[model samples]
Target chain A: MAKKSFFKRITLWRYLFLTLCFIVVIGNPFTNYYWDINFIQGWFQSIGIGNLWVVSPLEGLESILTAKFFYMPSLVGMVIPVTLAFLMGRVFCSWMCPIEFLSLLTDKILGFIPKWGKDLKYRKDLVRFAKYTLWFALVAELMITMIIGYPMFVWWSPPGLVGRETMFYVFYKHITIEAVIVVVVLLMNLITRRMFCRYFCPLGALLALIGKKRQLVIEYNASKCVGCKICDKRCPMGIKPSVGESQTVYCWNCAECVDACPTSALKFVWRDRGFITLPKGTKGESAV
Target chain B: MKRERKTDRREFLKVTLGAFMGGALFSSCSLSDLKNPKTMVKSPIKTNILRPPGAVSEEHFAQKCIRCGRCGEVCPYHCIKYFDVKTGGVFSGTPYIDVMEKPCYLCMKCVYVCPTGSLVPCAKEEVRMGVAVINRQICVSWQQDKTGLMCKTCFNVCPFSGVAIKIDHDFRPYIVEEYCTGCGICAYSCIADTYPENNGKKAIVIQPIKWKKIKEIKLEDIKKS
Candidate 1:
């Protein structure tokens, strides 16, 4: 429960994760070495072993499970992020999402101006709802495509659109409709607060649902609570850990609450099982 | 708290417009390379036995490839890769077969497990997809007074077991048109040619194309061979 450095801490992890993401997005040696082989692609194509359900093809692993009923392996990318979400509740948004970092940096930059200049608006609820709606549509479209043997969602995933279109424009000087979609999505992120993640990302929601009951979660100790409400203010997702249960689906386990707690009342514990309360004679007890 | 209301309105407009744009403006630009003849290469086999046509391409391949380390997974010869999506779109989120270190041996496993038809069946037959064409002029066997040892590199690198291409007594390399599956192993493993200007590698770059039958070699042609 010892006080943690603010900008020094979060920015470190953020920068590291963003750099990896950049490498993934741009052609780096890692992807070329690990991702290109047929066996690995085949393994990924397989469903039970971890076929990303979102936008990957239904041919290899999907073919066996659904008999080619539904396929889209790009969803496999969600495995790590979704798994992290379950353990730490949307940690991907906080720790490793390139898009989230982009928006956060933009928001900070925008903060420099006063009045309307810095006070940009975000459509978290409605646009964020779009991510869920898009998820629903993706599922519905996937189901239909499975039965009909057509690729509905895969044809137009935003990730695919941006990846293909932007590269095409840059490399070949040609812009397709997919490239336009990438632009629109970026503009949306620019205006809103992580709109793609809040509304459009089905994988995020799936992980969030699982994370609500994860074994490890953030805990608020009422005994140490001064009720200063600093933790509430520090939460990026607008979650209130002080008033109620800390097991909310939006909690990303960023440890921001732990860092923000002036009295060191907040702790991230594995379940309610391990109780590592503030060290007896340290600063937290002194504050108490 | 004071800025929350206007923030909410602005948020709404942006999300609504974004979703609308994502849906309305979306198109598959990944397939642009297929349209260009310069990037297109013809396949060897006429009757493709793999995934149905219209199913395999850069865009379709991108969605289907799970970014798994598999194709790279089973390669005794590590030549495949899951391309990144953000970089130049050439191989985004798809498996790109690298023949630089070692070329493919006409093994169709890549096509078989593609989960999607990114690498189609008859990939071997689709010599247009990944065939090895030689730069004969740069080939040591074809030119230069250096020891012929460097010349047979293409013939030595060929994995079709000498059926596709052969080494002449003079150490000249000749491709057997009928036997060559166009796997590109020969071109990829060729030690004689090193040209950086043309994609920083040797070998003729083949692209996947629609399959068609290759004409039969005549007996007189065999005598010439």
Candidate 2:
């Protein structure tokens, strides 16, 4: 049989979406000219989708820590994405995060380079719980340091670094140390798939916490089981989605597993019941 | 019993990992920078740089601004620039207006777009950006009237003429602190600005000081011939 077209599938919409957002972010009409040289960064700063962030949750948490409730617009920014995370799972990780997109692309590109290999192989359990630990500690630090007036994690956020660098490099043709650091992190994906994201992204950790109770999620059916382990290998975060069906938040819902499932047993359950087979007619369809 | 022991070990590991990452992040950024990078050694030429109009005190502004760059987008004159990492990691993302490159035109849009109160929202008339001070020594208007070097660039461009800035009987320009909003329009529009001796500096320049520092300009401060 002919191989399935990755671009002709539902998951491709996400790649298309992130690519468009990348364009809008880089095309931000922000800065005024300095010496007729346009030094641009963060023009669509308010245009949330372009950067996939209006403001970070850490910014809101900082305001809450400082007790500036009446005027905290950052809290409002936080609410929108968290609400969306509740609606779906960690769709931010797969669909919208530029760093995630860059890392995934790096993983693909590195496949082409001869002799390039993933050097550090971590135990799966440690990687699974790593993000949660990061989220908790960053929040803990934010609460402790709020009195001193610092937005702590905003200093080296992956999303902000990607957004800011793209804008600067595309428009101003400038690259600073912060931009270089993000690129270095991107380059590390050549050594380990989604390395920075899997290990250290606090924003993803926060969203995953919010998305743990997500109503729309993947349902595993034993009736159609062949135990092929295709979906097991497909998960980007290395979560054994075939085994840990209950661990919904860790799943990016990229539908590569559903695409990879030979029996087509894996399907998205919305307002789910126990065993709703793919509605008879649409046996092999997944649209998100 | 085995399950309970495993859970305890996992909990211990999680907390240790959490504290380590947390401590590493916190100390590595601001704390470590203090000792190693010295990123926040204070911009030695701090005051001369113009901030967005209605901007709070520099110290508070630096702390308050999350540096999203919203002000730069809505700026009709597009005057705001985010200070990059070159400006110390602390000040890197804050918006600043470089007067020599692009001065604030008193659009007051930036103040409106500022998500935080880093740039306070105030009317154009109320925006005291910085005081436009004149150097009488090099001002052509201050030179010999008989030498035919008298200029009216400052007077013609003053947003609030006859009040904020005034041309005296002798044609020398004087600033009135009470009425001057420090919009920097007069300074931006100064034609008598020249190079070589002044190195292309404006004859009239806006000094980036808070309005509270202007000290009720005593009438005797200005020398009238």
Which candidate tops DockQ?
Answer: 2
Q: For residues B1-225, what per-residue lDDT tens digits would candidate 1 score against the true structure?
A: 869998999999999998885443222223323432332322111211112222354324433433433344344445543333232132233445544544566555544444433445553434433334556655656665643444566666665545567766776667655655545566566654454543445533333434334445343543444
For model 2, the chain A TM-score is: 0.74
The fraction of reference interface contacts (C-alpha pairs within 8 A across chains A and B) present in each candidate is 0.16, 0.22
Report the C-alpha displacement of residue B36, candidate 1, in angstroms: 23
TM-score of 2: 0.74
Candidate 1 global lDDT: 0.48
For all predicted structures, in order, the TM-scores are 0.50, 0.74
Docking class of 1: incorrect
Over 4 Å off, model 2: A1-8, A30-45, A48-54, A63-69, A72-74, A111-131, A140-148, A169-173, A245-248, A271-288, B1-45, B143-148, B189-195, B199-202, B210-225
Write model 1 residue lDDT over A108-221, tens digit each, in one string: 666666675434532232233422353564366446544433233333445444334433343334555445554565677664555665565544555566567675567678
User: Lowest-scoring 10 consecutive residues by lDDT in candidate 2 chain B?
Assistant: B31-40
lDDT (Cα, tens digit) per residue for candidate 2, span A190-217: 5555666666666676667777777667
Best model per TM-score: 2
Clashes of each: 52, 1
lDDT of residue A45 for candidate 2: 29
